[model samples]
Target: MVGVAMGGFCLAPFAGPVLWRLLIEKMSWNWTMWVLLMFARVTVVLIATLAETYKPILLKRRAKKRGLPLPPKLPTGEALKLVVMMTLQRPFAMLLTEPIVRALSVYMALVFAVLFGFFEAIPYVFTSVYGFHPGDTGLTFLGIGVGLLIGAAIFMFLDRTNMSLLCVFQCHRRLNPDCCQQKSERWLSLPIGLFWLAW
Candidate 1:
């Protein structure tokens, strides 16, 4: 979630200036499409590297690779079906039943809406309140842009904090360095899932 949102937030702010520059320079939408196409291609590369990190799935693959005998199957496959059903149902169940989720959802939704609204409202605010001219209104957004960059730096601090906490347990109980590296990567796999889903 953090990776996807961070990546999305990072990309979205620059998109306007890029498109505007293309329009002013080339006077055609072709350059805009080309830039978007390049972004699409980079996302395509992420698909191959992003992979399953589920413990059960990883264990199953390891067992298959080693030619290990598998456990007996459920007679009617009902257990597997039930697990899948619950997995699909749990998020909606939480959203409906959990007050914390509802509150956070409302808070974040409102915050994001206001953030986008502020783009348009900046011109109006400066024009009405501060008496900024039509041309100078563009300057008001510089502070917001700089804020986004600083927020991104702060975001990296949070990401590193979370990663360290997650990997610390696995890093300690290790005789081999490779096992520790694997564990740390396993924690990182959680965040990398967002990129593929974002694509």
Candidate 2:
């Protein structure tokens, strides 16, 4: 349930223009929002049927089988400190130290900026180039939406592949240090993609 809600939260901003485009193209912006609200009502109905997963209950049952004592709850202050330490400090450390995470964070930040800039420019571009009204201008955002979906699908396909092959000599032993040093050169692909995407 939480995952679904988070997913919806992440997607909500991008959905705004798409929902506006889907409604009557000539209607006022208020009516378009009303249509969106109706769609949300349908979404609520769809989500009401799902079952919840109770992880704590299952974990306690397994602990009893192993003759382990029940887990103790942390004090409120300790729990808050642990959450802050894990969520902020650990992720910040990883951002600085992990090459893949650093590169991907930069890439995603740039992509989001570009997308927002394109969205901001859409009104000027459509009005100046084609003299399109607001509703028609909203429709152009569909192209951005389609491109985002395509890019996401491509990344999903690449992520599922065993990319370790690119770094390893075989499935058993790791690549030699000499080979790994030379292969580090190929990590230049990240910058190359940025250049290509920029063009």
Candidate 3:
């Protein structure tokens, strides 16, 4: 459900220039805003129909409707304090204490920044370097979509290969050091390392 809604936000940035071109060129600037607003409204309506996932809120609602006893609960202030403390501490602890998670998190952050930065930089290159119009610039985003598909395919292939090897290797030896060595080697593999650097 989260992925589905997130997809719409990703799609909009890629599709925005095309939509702008169509609406502004054929209709008017005002029409573009109106049409985009309509799409926003539609997205809200569709996503609003999704079932609630927050456990505490959902349990409370169900208990009310069915006249059932609610589960024993923490006091509101204490619960809020615990939630806040855990939320902050969990990530901080993982970042400080877990080498693998920290490394992966940092790598992902860099990649994310590069991806969005490229999207923003596209306009500068297309408009200034290539002398293209603003509308034509969105077409260039097709490259980003294609690159994502290819990268995802490669990542899935790498992940599957790792899992299969892990199963086989673990059957032959203890997992701790062996698994870590294999994972590190794979992470340092030249092609994938270069691929990540290219981002």
Candidate 4:
């Protein structure tokens, strides 16, 4: 589910350029900006309304399930301040204390740097070298979009296979101890993908 959701998000980089180009061509840039602003405003309103209603219901349900008194609500300003502090501090704290988190953070930073570099370079390469029109340049991002989809699919497939294997191993281990002594191979695709990207 998460992989599917993330794959959908990964489409945004490719889709954004094409969508923006079409919108600008259909309506002028000024109107395109206005339309986008209106869309963002509506999205924000919906999310805010839903979040406000959802949180109390979720808290109540959890409290009932645990047979505990309802949690006390913090003052709005205090709650916001606490959230802001945690959001600001937690990532840095994890990067400092957790080696895995630090490594992943660096890897993600490098990935984003490469991705954004391509975003800038692709337009120039298509327009100057390939003699493509500015509008058609957006289609050059299709490779990246396809790559993201493939990666997501690979992750989903490998994750499910690993889980099934684990279940089978668990049952076998019940019959024979030490039968399930193997490391998970679910993360094997990560290095393979990285090497493919480098190549």
Candidate 3 vs candidate 4, TM-score winner: 4
Task: List the global CA lDDT of all models.
Answer: 0.61, 0.63, 0.63, 0.64
For candidate 1, report its TM-score. 0.51
For TM-score, candidate 1 versus 3, the one ahead is 3
Which 10 residues in a row give candidate 1 its minimum summed lDDT?
Answer: 171-180
Q: Model 4, 1-199: lDDT tens per residue? A: 5434544565556556545655564556897678678878988987777644477788899899999998788999999998987998887788899986776677667656766766777678778877998777756666766676676576556445554466555633321111122554534554675566445
Model 2: residue 169 alpha-carbon error in angstroms: 11
Pairs of colliding residues, candidate 4:
none
Measured against the true structure, the TM-scores of the candidates, in listed sequence, are: 0.51, 0.57, 0.52, 0.56
lDDT of 1 by residue, 30-57 (tens): 7677777887899899876899889877
Per-residue lDDT tens digits for candidate 3, residues 1-199, read 2233334444556456545655554566898879878988998998899788999999899998999998888999999999888999788998999987787678657656755666667667778877988766666666666655554454445445554466555633222321244566654654574475355
After TM-score superposition, the amount by which residue 110's alpha carbon in candidate 1 deviates from its true location, in angstroms, is 0.8
* Model 3 spans with C-alpha error above 4 angstroms: 1-70, 153-199
Model 1, CA-based lDDT? 0.61
lDDT ranking from best to worst?
Answer: 4, 3, 2, 1
Residue 181's lDDT in candidate 4: 29
| lDDT at position 165, candidate 3 | 65
Report residue 16 deviation for candidate 2 (angstroms).
Answer: 4.5
Worst 10 residues of 2 by lDDT: 172-181
lDDT of 2 at 111: 54
